[model samples]
Target: MTTAPPDSHPPAAPPSTDVEALRREVATLREESSRLRRMLDTAARIAWSHDVRAGGGEPVAPAWQAFTGQSLEAFGNQGWLTVLHPDDRAGALASWADAVAAKRSFSTRYRVRRADGVYVWMLAKGTPVLGLDGEVQEWVGTCSDIQDQCLREERAAFLARAGELFSSSLDAAATLATLANLSVSAHADWCLVDLLHEDGHFERSLVVTADPAQLPLATIVRSLSPVPRDQPVYPPSVALTTGRSTLVPEVTAPLLEAVAQDANHLATMHQVGMRSLLTVPLMARGHILGALTFIITKSGRHYGDEDLQFAQELANLAALAVDNARLLQGARDAIRLRDEFLSVASHELKTPLTPLSLKLQVLSRAVKAHPDSPLAPVIEAHVETGHRQVRRLTELMNDLLDVSRISAGTFRLQREAMDVAALVREVSARFAPRFALEHCPFTVDAPESVPGCFDKPRLAQVLDHLLDNALKYGAGTPVSLTLTADGAAARIRVRDGGIGIAPEQRSRLFERYGRAVSERHYGGLGLGLYLTRTIVEAEGGRVSLESRPGEGAEFEVMLPLQQA
Candidate 1:
């Protein structure tokens, strides 16, 4: 009835009792395989294999192609090496080769390239799969992206160290020193700082080379001799001038020659082995204050845009730190200037008193005749001097009052008939002590009487400035002061043996804050000559100078007999 009549087929095999169990086992294995693939996807890891005998390598599973977004053809025999960063390639390969030959486990970390040409940190690990008889059959490996974790940790650590260095001191120079030391092994081998002066000029402020061999070169460039002041060129100069960033991937002979101040400089560059350079202008509030330069010397490292970007960021912080330190130093300098002026003013205030004692000699006879010790002659002679000194003291309140007022075009003068010769004599006697201290022989020549209608106090100030300038710029040479009268005016001449003035500076000699000498060699407010000219012109007089470098300088002033 159940088709049993169809006995043509052989006897049907009995249904095994293990059939259902076998089916269950197969289902379990399928579930496990799916779960493993899901796990691989979630971990961002891809499996790969290499058959030593077959002489080829490929992804053991499709996960590698999916994760890397790369085609099989693109992943050549040494595809892993192609993704390895240049800096880490050699070490990574060496490690892998050793492991593959020994048929052992291996692990390493390095930057790997993605399909889009981006590089990232990756942890690659592999193990050898053995065949029968314990011989090596194939090698299995996995690749995972660890770029984010590694970069995050590294950045956090570096920033923390950098923050500590920056906060350690408010001194811009000191902070830069620390930065240079810390960055020598990491950022660059040499660090340089160029600072902008208030006059809109640049000077090398600092140079540091971690490598000892380059110290001499750094010294020569920074101290022995400096860049030409006339040329406003170079990478740092361009960056500062344009307020942008500049990069020099390789330091060529022509580049070195162009920047070299002399043959010796070019030779020094050869000894230093300069390779690459990064120049970033220190900018704040829309103005370029200076430039920070980082150089690769002896390291032979390639600096890319990201490197430049990081350098610029550090430069920004450096600029801020430098500005902050400068501000603080300025405040301190202001305080120091105030104190110095106070001391100088006090000394100057006392200086007039000594000259008054000279007048005392002239008043002795008259004073002796008065029964009450009249002291009338003394009082009469000193009345104007005391008033002038009092006014001079008032002028000291701002320390720069005279210069400021003159520059602001709000200066005024009071005139009277004064004996020019007598005032000159008094001032010369007052300067005797200072000249002696400088080992300078000073002489004064004046007629017995040279009368003029002038402001005595202002004339005294003018003489003081001229004399001070002569002594300061004299270079320890003799100074001479001469006064003579002409047909309509009285002339005073101050000459000194000093590093003299250049012809170009003659026109601006009397300009306010004009400097005819290097600050490293001479220092002042640059207001002395200007003040002399201003006061003399206000009194219907004129000022002039004559000089040549290494010869000496002579300053002359003319005072009209009549008021302007």
Candidate 2:
């Protein structure tokens, strides 16, 4: 070889044999094919080839036959179409026909029966295999398992809808009925919600079915008394008793017999056609309120872990809604009863107070008439003390009446042109004797006249309450009232040198029954500031407080000069 000419290069080693080159190419192709098959298997995708022109073709993909468990001969005759869900067949075929006519890529989603006899969602996509002339020769496609993804999306949508229904209102009966109806429409053929009452009794709160004709049969099923919790055959009872979810994948005749209460019950159960059931206890705040039962009928759907989880989520929402409604109703009833009691008590107390006031006035006059008598001073002192006590009772009765009126939505204001300065002076004079008794020095600063359209009696009441508050808590310290008019509003501030409120207590001081002091030390209902704030707000005004512990507190009221 070395002796040959440099240009020849020893015949180039026979050009590397045609058979060896072909073998290397074949090996490369085999490796690529194996990689593609691995990719398809890992992705749960089955590839198939169909000859549209011939209407059918022999199964060429072992994956397809393995996935559907179809024999080669059966698959050749298009037996795979039989595995498609009955409800989806018509639409799927129609889409395929359209895609074939247009000679374009095809994509669709449908439920397909698996080798295990369970239906799973699949996303099928296909592309036309074109020949050299750009005419379609056949179709190549893939079927991918999308069951988990579809179920997740479905569950999310269902819960979102359930949340909307639950938030619509705090009415228990209406909301539970809506929830039952929604369940039947989305996930169940029938839904029954049974609630456990406080008296340990069970009541079927709602029963809804998808088919209108089945309403009578549902009613019959509802009439059948629930099975005892000791018997684990009944799902609802089991769920309610254990406070856990129960799922019955399939309902058998023997199981139905075990759950039935009587012959009529068994007959009704058969007529209702329950195929599967899921029950979840309605849990709220660590308590089980009830059980929500979901039943499948002719749809032949089965309840699985995913269905149970969804039902549990729905039940949680339902429980919260029901609990909230019940709490709200309870509060309303309590308020109503309190208002009624206040109205009657105020009226009854007033009835006796009027005559007592007259008697005290008569007694005072008689004692004054006998000024020359030896017992004149003692009798006079006793009568004055009695008068003070009577006045205090009257004030309390009036406050109760006002609260009742407000609660009943009957509180009204009579606005009239009046001198606020004059009203403030009158209230101050009325409270003068009380301030003196408590040894609290009172001072008032105001203009001679501040003209405004306001509710006179209500304003007087507000002034009286503020002064009394100062007298009670001021503890004989100096109290001052300052009044000023500024730009469409009247500002009145009462500063009291007494046991000042803590910063934390100020926010709660304005709510009904909110108090910063104990009843043992303070001798009035905790309604004064609440009533004051309510009146001020109703008149387009505001009230605020400024104070620190052990420092004097100043309460301010700003009222619109003109009534709305």
Candidate 3:
């Protein structure tokens, strides 16, 4: 990209002799080269040419001095390295050397010191200028300042990293760590994430600094910050109370005097060379969760309006994390409370079952002994009714205990080798009198011996629920209990000829407190089917039902033969 130099002299009038002609040609070429150099500099591009034979030399073009406001004497051969950023100097030099040795073009990005002493990003490049016979002559290149574009790209990268971190986890601690790492990038020297408690007290949840050595000191100082809201001294505290952002662009003496709560905090601020600060409240669903604090110190970086906007974006992610953690914690607390209540309530209701059962037994024995008496028939009938009532009460209490065990995560079964078919027959016999009372025919089809390992009482309870469900809903319909088994598992079926379940009701019939029919027509705790399913699954089994409106419902319980 050569152009005419500001100072150029036209070739002298042609000479009549050979020596004069050669001299005139040389002067003409020199003026043309000077004009090209001037054009390159005027374009605001640093055009440089290094002598390949000398290995390296002062730039043949004066573009560097013209653009940077530095003299060529100041940038003698290889002196350009002095103005390069220390981190980029070694690499830039090595690249130049390799390009020259290989006689090829080279390009790289590095930060160069401008005349104003500010470092600006530059794209340095070089291309070999070949002579006749394909011999390398010089390396020509230009350096274009790309500082503003580079800054913009870096900022975009920072925001992308922050977004990735926020989406990676829901844990509060991990989210805090992400925020800390984001600040470590060019944004700030230190970052802190704080959470407000239910009582409106601030908890310094996390504090991080890009400088590893300063982390401990930052943590200690943060622990003592957020002075009383009435004082509203620190930026973090002010941001929290107002539900807005606070900025301390310059930590001047007057600013420190007002911000610091005491000498200890002030000393820490000075020790950390805190200069600029921004604190934005972490808000979630219109609720202030906490604050995200960012600090710039001796790094000379200051907070600006764009920085405030960036900080608020980061704060939003922090707020979402805080809100998610709070919700999970609240759910846990509620479950804990519910389990405790279930345990207490079950024990209280079960306490009276023992005495009630004993009293019913005593009454039966007395009526049996007075069978020949005149009022024997009526007394026997009353005793039988009492027995049925006692049985109902016992089932109710047992359901409560099962629910409590399930809530406590302590539901267990005592496995014993037995004939499952025989067990079913025994439980069915207990329901015979009730079937007779309701004028419903009852039947049981069970094999003589279908061996398996199971909790006898739990199986009996399951049978009680299935049979009772049938009798209650299918009151006048015939109720049948059947047991069958293959080599791998045993299956029990309870089918009733009553009003079938509706589609909507059947779906939720197995849920706790779920009722398929109105209480006015049928009475139950609605835990029968739920407990049935729970106990069956706990024993490595499954329960399912097929029902249709106006048809009948058939419940099938399958239990695996093997139990561990």
Candidate 4:
């Protein structure tokens, strides 16, 4: 036990604690903790940590407590799953457990209850922090708010589907029903469409629900007096009257009672389990078409401003489709009426014209017989003018009859073996007088024998229309008609040096009642080209136009030599 020298021996035992070193270590830990808290606060990431060994009994992070309004004591033992949506909890737990067992990364999506009681969608991801032994020490994760993004994606998909469904049909009632059904299947538990009649009363156009078993109840609800105008508190009535959207996020008993009509209605309303209501006016072209009502029931969805906006968008599409259907129906009705009138009038007028034409011919013969008399020339001229006028009237009546036949799908062709060149020459000869009257030069280039099996009368009529247009629009310029046998088809071209069609007007030239020039300036019905095209196509031929503004126009008709 000899005492060692001061230099070799260890220094006298230090103080019980090195105060400076301990203080520095404590300061460093506090700075680290403050830095972590600042990082968590600044990022959208909601930082959370779970003790791997503690299992369900582990304490939750302060961020989780703050974000979800779950305190450590409240979250004790049960784990964070207690705060998750019932539908999402099991899936989230399964994914998290798998990641923990494998000691790897974890990722999942879930709906968690917020302080405001709304279950918001979140994307949570975690990375296992391993100890030195390579076992999982803990799990560090962050939950990002994805509710708005999820809703936006869902809404976009729904609108795309709705657009397709609405545009698929043109029937007004069917389109309305589709809207209601689509709304129920996508966003709402129940949907109803109410149309406003001309008498200012509402008619329940349709009602649809997500649950088929509830259809009977939905029918009863639909049958309920179509949202009386007196009840301004009713969602549909309010929307229709104000022509604005209405949203009730929460449907309270008092509100239901306020809107219910009678005891049974009230009881039925209660049974409906309405959690929310949204109504939007269906409007088009400055008129209110109807009201579209959406209701959330056992689905537990609340109507917010965003939902109201979506409902209004849907209402706009439905209204447009309904209005378009109505317009189309009205047009069809008008066309039918016009066709009926034309069919009756043409026959009635033609009945008198036959006898009238006979009388004109008799008078013309009697006047010609008195050619030696002084007044014979004057009377003969008058009679000839009467004959011309009757012919013009007959042509007009025939045109109207042809139009009616085409519209009714009764236009038929009597095909025969005939020379198309002879037909073209005959039609050109008929227009010679008119071309001379207008001082327009006309020419026809054709082979003497261009025979084909075709509808001779219809082909003659087609040539007649083309020559008539050339004579009228030739503007006193040269007009040419060329017919040839090209391969297995017969080609006829009528070229006119007159006011040519504009590019845009050419497309409408063959449509019924379509005209490029003003009717006030030109004196003929606009049906000539339409009839020509119909007759030509019926004979297994096609008519095409080549024209430009301020230039000449050329119309070509290609007819199959052997009709099939």
Candidate 5:
């Protein structure tokens, strides 16, 4: 064999052989291209291209048949337009026209009806190709299915607006009306708000119109109850009583039969067109204030937990508004009562002051004229009684002024570091003589070195009021004053073996003008405990009480220890 030399080059292939190799390579390229085409054809989404100016060039791409289950010829010359929803057709066309006119990329989302009559949201995006001269040549695009995304966005927007409406207004009636309007607008249904009356009944206060004129007046009149709780069927009284949200779907024949016994059932059914009902209890401070009822008329749609929860939230806000309104009304009534009391008190004080002043003037002259006579003692006694009356008047005026100052946030405290034990002992000793006069046993237990920071005058005033209460209420019973301390705080407890407070009255014990029902037995303006709480709280301390009916009451004041 004539083998080539180690350094020599090999002979070149013949032209025929080279041609055959090139042919094989071209065949492989063609096979690969065919495989890629098959893959694209199998994709769910259709890929397409179009010339901007040449509108009807290639009727439909091959991929359209795979995606839509239709032949390419079916969409000849913009025939795909027929598949667009009528509501979306105009907008889609306008958008395409605008994009072509501006020579810009086009992107849009719209609903397209499939051949099977199912509508789906489609997201279409296409970019216009340009020549070197900036003239539009061809366009490339893809269509993606986005039905679920669109629905979610729509629901989210509805929820956001509903939340805004629920939080924006503080008037229950206005809020309910707004909620009704929102319900009708969002769900495209008739809405109703039935508020529970104090007498345990449901009254429709607000109605949103789907068709106001067509609403059956007789049906509404008959179906609604001024006393829903008294009825046997479709009653909302239980929900209102328990403060719960209730949903009733499609008033079945049995429910209708049960409610038919009531005269209002027919009228209510007619008025509300009630196919489904959702009842939400409006509650304030754990009590049922009312009920919010929504009636859906157009469809037999059942209210789900989500719908009930939303309604409940609205009801809760409405309940707060209702409570606020009630509080405002109560305040107005209290102001009126306070004004009347002030007028009466002013007259009473004036009546005493006139005689007191006259007596003091006469006694002063008489005492000067008969300084050594026995008549001086009689005049002096009369003078002292007049002075006591004057002092009482002064105290009433001071109490009223102090209350006003505290309410206006202008009350000032003169704070000082002092021995709390010493203060307690001094106050107790002062009250000891009073206890002796009343024949009541008194005890004081003051721990040495119990120091705290507080306003001495204010704390003394608190102690005076507490001792007064003990004397006034614990007549003929033992009263105790005890001072105790922990590392961080000091406490002074004044307890009395007096008539204790009722459980129901304890919560309002510190509220201004709050007096127990048995207050008629005690002579006071009801400002003592309120003032005490205010003074203590201002010094960064707290006052609390422990007692039960028939047992003695103990008032405990805790003050934070000031760092040395």
Candidate 6:
């Protein structure tokens, strides 16, 4: 080797310290490059750099491949442009061109096709590199996936639109129809509404965008279920009862399999290609009124919390609208009935008045003609009977007029400072004779002084109705009237030991035209308690009742006491 020529030995002669230094420098550069690559990979976005003039560049960085599942050969040399959404292509290219011409940073949001062929929103941003002469050199940019953000925005928009539609209409049918149409537009396959009846049964009120045949069969089957007369199948009823939304991912396999095995849910699911369902409760003032069911069929999409919340809001609006419509219909019906009743009542009242006036005139003439005739006593008794009948007719007319006034909001109260005790005493004295006539014992308990500001005539009317109801329904049982003062309030309670009201009917007893079935047998208009409540409330007071079937009923009136 020592004897070899310099040419053959080549670099062996330059075994110097600089060689080790160069090796160290190269190793340091390699480590730096690896560190930069890892930093880019760890970032949420994928990075790329391209020369504007060359129109050719290195393939996408490793991060780009990881994000899009595409290789360098597939994306380099403008090949990656194919992955952009068709709708976004023109805008994206225009943005890039503007950025290049202006020699400034560029940023834009557009849609890109993923490896699975699903278009997803993405944000791309880049800054231009410049040479010493200020000419553009290259563009370095990143693309960040924003699909989740875009979907959230879309969902928010859909909910806003739904709110606008539901809140604008009061027609129950139109509202339900709008809801169904919106559901369909929002990608639901079918929607149906079921309303609960007073008898605790559910009846299909509307079916939107659902198969016609399925509607009839579904309703018939639901009506025939063994659960109860007014209850729906378990899942739907549970949602209604609990006032919560229920989501069943696979209804046929898990939910329907348990209770409604023979239900045509499986066939319906196949026909509609449904895989998930949502049932939302419709409630107003804590009472379950109905339910709305939405089915997702085209795609087996699992409904999430967001979807449930949206559907629940829609159901809530629809429920309120339906409840309002029902109330309006009830009011119209009440007015119609009231008109008819008034016509009949006017005719009956005239019949009694005519005879009453004639009897009084005859009595006056007979008394003037014979001063000592034996027929005087008989005439006097007959005149007294006529007077009682006339009084009864007058009371009936007053009750009807009071009801109408209360309904029209024209009933104004005349407030006066009075002793509640004295008023109660006066009403008790007046009712004492009637109680004796009916052979019903009556008792009164009161404080020496129960001062309150109240409407005297209205209060008297209320007491009279309470006493009459107690006497009529008490079935010869003792009736007790009590008056007391409790810290800034006066309390008057009338209790009767008679057939009491059912617990279920107590809530509606004070409502207009509301009466217990037991009370209906007593043969009177159902406006007594309604008028009583209206008068009490107008005077800034409240009335409540407590009773149980076969145990007697207690009615309490509370009025604010006058300040000392």
TM-score of 2: 0.77
In model 2, the worst 10-residue window by lDDT is: 7-16
> How much lDDT does candidate 3 score?
0.81
Between candidates 4 and 6, the one scoring higher on lDDT is: 4
Q: What is the TM-score of each candidate against the true structure?
A: 0.41, 0.77, 0.75, 0.80, 0.47, 0.49
lDDT measured at residue 70 in model 6 versus the true structure, 0 to 100: 76
Q: Model 2 lDDT vs. the true structure?
A: 0.85
Give all candidates' CA lDDT scores: 0.76, 0.85, 0.81, 0.84, 0.72, 0.75
lDDT score of model 1?
A: 0.76
Better of 1 and 2 by TM-score: 2
Off by over 4 Å in 5: 1-94, 102-170, 197-202, 210-223, 229-238, 241-264, 271-276, 284-286, 298-305, 320-564
Candidate 2 RMSD to the real structure: 7.3
Of the candidates shown, which would achieve the greatest lDDT relative to the real structure? 2
Tens digits of per-residue lDDT for model 2, 103-182: 89988999887776667899988789888888888987778999889989988998888788888889999889988988
The whole-model C-alpha lDDT of candidate 4 against the native structure comes to 0.84
Identify the candidate with maximal TM-score.
Answer: 4
Clashing pairs in 2: none
Q: Considering lDDT, which of the candidate structures 3 and 5 is the better prediction for this target?
A: 3
Arrange candidates, best TM-score first: 4, 2, 3, 6, 5, 1
Question: How far off is residue 187 in model 1, in Å?
Answer: 1.0
Write down the worst ten-residue block by lDDT for model 4.
Answer: 56-65
> Model 5's lDDT to the true fold?
0.72
Tell me the lDDT of candidate 6: 0.75
What's every prediction's RMSD, in angstroms?
22.2, 7.3, 7.9, 5.0, 14.6, 14.1
Deviation from native of the Cα of residue 297 in model 3, angstroms: 3.5
